[model samples]
Target: MEQLKLAARNARKKTIVPVKQVRIGEGFVVIAGPCSVESEEQMLITARMVKEAGADMLRGGAFKPRTSPYAFQGLGLEGLKILEKAGRETGLPVVTEVVDPRDVTWVCEFADVLQIGTRNMQNFALLKEVGKANKPVLLKRGMYSSLKEWLYSIEYILNAGNPHVILCERGIRTFETYTRNTLDISAVPAMKELTHLPIIVDPSHATGRVSMIESMSLAAVSAGADGLLVEVHFKPEIALSDKDQQLNPRQFKQMMWKLRKLVQFHQQLAKQKSPRGET
Candidate 1:
């Protein structure tokens, strides 16, 4: 069971978008962009394509956390500048990760929604920084963190000041070697019961395969996720980060079509299930 104290704490606070901008009750929100900001052209190309696919928001990592020091880290402030430019051009809200607590101010200046990536879920200091930002925040579960700890992390943000925090189940580390991480579909309904915060799923990172995005996304919405955070690239094979999980423009468009239909059906079902004039 989740700690009700934190849940209650989150309930009384206000959100950045009034629960209507990012997404509505069980309304599917599609957030897509490159896994990491590579260059000006790369970011704009992906953002334009995703916007054309009807994505509700655009996501990209400006300060990526790489396991290997030699791997390409994000473009830092330059990457953020690219994302901002894309958002301006496409009219899609920008979402990106903030790896360090000190960069909170810089990120808030560009990103519409501040993302606390899975690697930074336990960064209490960073969480506090986002908690105080005026923008809405997207918080991902750590690869090794528990559900309880996940909620507590949310508390860390809520207690700090900000309340427009969205939970994202990006998958967790496990013994299985077949996939990058174990996508915890159960976290969807479990989180719903534990808190009113809107929840989203990241199928790209969860399965670490482009082919699995459609099915996992469908399952996520079916499981009651409020939105999806997908990684889209003009050419996934050459993406700077998480190339294996990135979706090409064509694949992303197809998934978006299916998601639109599913969201409509789910909304109809919800209306029918509710008591007359209750919802």
Candidate 2:
């Protein structure tokens, strides 16, 4: 818990991030969308599906950070406009990644939640920049980072002033090749004990297989995670980024059907524990 003044453990209280009508830590909030905003039509279709399926927020990458330099690096400002319009039409809050410290300010104009991807989890400058913004931030765990390191990075944001922060475990790098990365399910409950922040899992990135998403998502929810960050494209097969990991909107709708029931059960259970349950 080194230098964890803001993100440190606090069993008596928890942080609740508000995204419009949805309160993230207060309940099971699902944010689903394409990995990147490919086109206006693509975004509109995807956003509508997720919203109709009961997702609380719409997530799309406007500034994708790719491993290859020559890959489709995202449509930048154009992508943001598409995402913003889709979110507006659907009435779902928008969440998009902010890669550079310079983009934090302008990105906020379009994004309700500014996401710090796994690749930039330790980007201190970007963290601080978002911390100063008016919007909440979704910070992902680095592929090679430990839980302690992740918390410290959160401090950089919290220390900058914004308390509306959410944690996402997209899995960690491991020797396994079958999946994109090894999902650390334990991190869900582990975060509950170590910090007051709400944590969600990204099964799409963690397992990197369409077959594994539903199961891992169920496991994450059952493990006491606050919510999930899922990748849902209208047609993942035609996606410009993370094609293998993205699920189609129809698949996401089906998954949402199950998740809604499970989440409702969890809500009822929480209500039973406390009449004024806000956790």
Candidate 3:
């Protein structure tokens, strides 16, 4: 845990990770986009939609890691190019997952924030590669990983000299089969107490149902999450991946409206709290 000294929370301050021009810990950021970049039009359309709905950043997978080999494995470098174009056209910083260590530099060239997916959460080589790069990293918690293990993984990045790291609690595997993964809403405040890194929640992957995302997202904010990573698609019915959990444009906007209020309330509550971790 000592290795994570820079990321650990203290009585004085919280770590603020900056990506592009957006200050993550300073405000409640909403990062929304499709699960995968299916086409140039898909990327641009969703990017515009999310941005119009007040999303702070755009998220799309260029190199998707799937359970089945026959599934849509993303559009690779072409997808990255389209994501970059969409970000430029919309003026939103883009975030994409980088699974392999070899693609770090290429992904960094286009992505404002490099994401380490759940499957690659403990990929030490990939973590080290991204840690060495000069970009913010969004490290998601592995489905099977414990909270302590998650902190140690962050240590790997902070120890490697990159201070810009964001902790994303995307849910963990539990006995429940009703959702893709159990939404660990408690992890939000727990992590806040354990580490200074800004923490965000991924309700899209947590519940794996459109109807549950809104509730879980609100719960996350109430639990002290710094932001959210949501999946939004123009037409989720025909999405390439994670269609069931991806919120359509309308749903996303509605959720954003609700989230804005929740964020304000959270900030107000924070202002009333004492500096010594007291309310």
Segments of candidate 3 deviating more than 4 angstroms: 10-12, 271-279
Return model 1's CA RMSD, one decimal: 3.2
TM-scores for candidates 1 onward, in order: 0.92, 0.95, 0.95
- lDDT values, one for every candidate: 0.86, 0.91, 0.92
Which ten contiguous residues of candidate 3 have the minimum total lDDT? 3-12
Give the candidate order by descending lDDT.
3, 2, 1
Backbone clash total for model 3 is 3
Candidate 3 lDDT over 1-279, as tens digits, reads: 655676677663788888878999988889999999999999999999999999999999999999999999999999999999999999999999999999999998998999999998899999899989889999999999999989988988988889999999998999999999998888888898898889999999999999999999999888878899999999999998998999999999999999999888877876785779654
As for candidate 3, its clashing pairs are: 8-196, 9-195, 9-196
Among residues 3 or more apart in sequence or in different chains, the pairs in candidate 1 whose N, CA or C atoms overlap within 3 Å are: none
Q: Which run of 10 residues does model 1 get worst, by summed lDDT?
A: 11-20
RMSD, one per candidate, in order = 3.2, 3.4, 2.4
User: Which candidate wins on lDDT?
Assistant: 3
